[model samples]
Target: MRIIINTGKGGVGKSTISALTSINISKRLKTLLISSDLAHSLSDLFAIKLTANPTRICENLYALEINPIIESAKAWQNLNSYLRELVKNNSLNDIQVEELLLFPGLEDVFSLLKILEIYKEGKYEVLVVDCGPSAETISLLSTGEKLNNLADTLVPLVKRFNSLLGGFIEKKTEVKKPKDIVFDEFVGLAKKLYELEKILMNPEITSVRFVTKASKVISNETFRASTLMNMYGFLTDCVYINMLYPEEIKNSSYDNLYLEERENVDRIEEFYPDKRVFKIYMKANEVIGLKELESLNEEIFSKIYLEEFFTACRTFDIKSEGASKIIEIDFKFASDKEVDVRRIGNDLELSYLNFKRRFKLPDTLSSRKISSYSIEDEKLKIVMDYD
Candidate 1:
């Protein structure tokens, strides 16, 4: 199955692009379009209602708005019920048991897990995802790999400890199984997760299409999103530069906002010379409902260059060196001044002017003490020292 992820600056017509693309693709292939953003308007765009399940919209199209609470209840209800029962029966603190259910990003993680469920059913040709804004979307995808590894290591230890504790605490009682089934379930979950990861990392089967507006706030954000996704092995296929001002206003000489917006388009193209970028003229009316969305799709292809698929020719590497790990990030544009850097616990944060990003240490490097850092060859070098 093919997976297409659309993410860009908010208010850049992302929902329009997602709706239009999914509808167009569905005419020729079976497609499942999913929106993970909290402010989802897929229902509004299609002029039909949507829920957590894959609701059939037309002949070949299905839509879903991922509801994490609903998904968690469906996927983990058995496990959670067992845990809650065990804790309550054992007289554990009520607050502690309740708090255990409140893990951060459980919803985001569970949303991704649902993809595996659909893929396992073996029913669709393409999976189109309208993910959250850049930060949360990338984080949502990367969390699975880290979690899969964590489950692998922790499940065994947890099973052993549960068995030892249960045996020692109640010698007269019948020996209870260590809930080893949970660990087995985790293994199954991890296997499915790993398959999804493999699919995303493969450029041939997966691609990211960015929908961006030509204004400043979103223009800069699109640039950063492009670099960040490329750094993480998600291949960006093409940039859909949406909402361009029409040149008809030039005769009236009312304002230069249109001219300024035109220049932003040129600037974005210059930043990524190696990739294909497509543009769309600003609509006369607001884009809403199925009719306008269909018009938006019709306007796309005539201006689009089919040969210019998204391409990535740069690499960012983070390597371990003794106690510290060195990160080397290369960007197409040069920094005019010293780039800003800050270390917060195990995460290294970097910023240049208004652009900022944070990265955590790899498992192999997080435990080491960072001795020193430097920038050379357009790469950040970090030396690690043993305590």
Candidate 2:
């Protein structure tokens, strides 16, 4: 399924763009548009009230304003309640316990869990996700890997440490130490976490699209979005340059606005030279309600004949040349930046400017077994074991 996640610096008109994109796409395909941000404006963008559950906004379009606060309670209620008990029993202040309930990872984790459920439903051809800002969005995608790896290594060690501590205390006080309820809760959480990661990294089922402005400050968000997308194998298909001023503007009063748009798009094009860059003209009024959204779509996508709602490049083809396997990585969305390649022990490390990722080698592979590496046809091909 095509998963478009629009995010960047706040007040970039993400909600409006997200709604219009979904509306335009739903015309041709079954689409599910979801808002993952706390300040929900999908309802406002559509000019129709909505609920947390999936609600039909149009013929083939579904919109959901996911209330993470509510979802967090539902998914983690059992665990959170258990945690609260421990905190209260230890004489921790109630306010502190409540604050602890709203942990850093719970919101992101619950949001991901929501996405997984929609993906499993297997109903929509495209899932348009209006995600949180850069940091939260990146955390949502990569947290699965990080959390899984952490739980795998730390849980057992933590359990063992708790056991040792419990035994020592029990012997000194001549009283049985209470069961490690916290550890058991963690183990339970770890299992659920593993499942979440599996679903997120399923390449066949998910992809990410970023909405960005053509400004210098916002460009940093693009760099980070690119770096994170690569780490999680998320194909960032399209980067929408929103609220661009027209080239025909002659008003000196608004010249700076037009100039900035030009420079922003130029900068973005330099960064993502090969990938398609779409520029949406600045509209007069806020894009709310179906009528305004339709007009906005016309103004923005007029050059594209209003055809497909999304733009992307999907190229993941592993070919065998004689005795070697060549895995090609697409860098179409990446500029002509210098790519750094090194062998850090058993992992192959590749980094370019703000982007980097490590690929672990299997037992059959050799460091020198890599026959060659080159960028051709907008793809980076790594040949393994070719004589």
Candidate 3:
């Protein structure tokens, strides 16, 4: 199955593009449109009430607006139930137990795990995801790497506690099994999360598209997001420049605004030459529902070929210049953020602000020392020494 992930900052029209694209593909493929936004963007866009359950939109399309709590409950039922039981046993109320158990972004990451479950079910041929806001999308996509929650820190301790005290406890003791179950469940969740990361990074099966309006403020943010997503190994297949001013806007009172927006559009195209940049002009009437989406379907699908990626390009590359290996990291727009680099064995820990991504060095580079480094334009080039 093919997965198309649409992400952008709030008010960039991601839900619009995600909805229309799903409707167009549903004509032939069994498509599932999933939205994690609590604002009910999908529901409002389609003009149909949707719930955590997938609702039938048309013959081949089904849409679901996820409740993050429901998704977390489904994935972490055992752990959640155990924690609640432990807390309730302490004379805590249900509300108090829930308050303690709920972690910020726990359900958000759980909703992301739901994508892997849906993909494995093999029921739908296509999965269109309306990811959360751009910043949240970055964190959510890195769930596997940054899964250092309470449970994560507690896993090893829990497993060790069970292992140390197991011999003293009776074979039929129920407590031992529960402890083991907690570890097992956490392992299961971690495995699925890693699988989700793998699928998202796979260029052949998944493509991430950025949706943004043609405005300098938003374009600057979009450019930064593109740089960050590349660092995370997610392929930005194309960019959808939504809500452009129509021809009639020329020579009108809004002409200058239109002209400035046009320049932003051209700049975005130039910034992403390898990626197919498509424009969607603002319509005279509000575009909503299936009937209204048919015209937009032609506009988007006629040019965007879903079967293959808009471009298959690697985010980072290594080149042999004489003897040294030059490692280039696409780290533009990241200048605003301070970076701290540390090496642990053969892995490089790239830290910037709150986020840290580990890059495993190749054998050739692992044995060598980083002789020098420089930031040229958008790339961070590192020189590896043969000595």
Off by over 4 Å in 2: 88-98, 167-204, 251-253, 302-387
Q: Each prediction's Cα lDDT score?
A: 0.71, 0.70, 0.80
lDDT of 1 by residue, 129-207 (tens): 8887877777776665666665767877887887778676546664434466766766766666667876776777777
lDDT of 2: 0.70
Better TM-score candidate (1, 2):
2
Q: Which 10-residue span in candidate 1 carries the lowest summed lDDT?
A: 301-310
Q: RMSD, each candidate, Å?
A: 6.6, 4.8, 4.0
**Clash tally, candidates in order:** 2, 1, 0
Number of backbone clashes in candidate 1: 2
Structure candidate 3, residue pairs in collision: none
lDDT of 2 by residue, 58-78 (tens): 799989988776767766666
Cand. 1 TM to true fold: 0.74
lDDT of 3 by residue, 1-387 (tens): 999999988987899989888987887799999997656688888889988888999999999988877677777788887777555547787676766766776767888877988999999999999987887888888887655342456678878877887656636553433557767787778767877888988888988899998888888888878887877778888888998889898899999998888899889988998888888888889888877776778866865545357898887788999988987777776662365556666777666556667756888789887777766787767778866
Query: After aligning candidate 2 to the native by TM-score, how far in Å is the CA of 121 from where it should be?
Result: 2.4
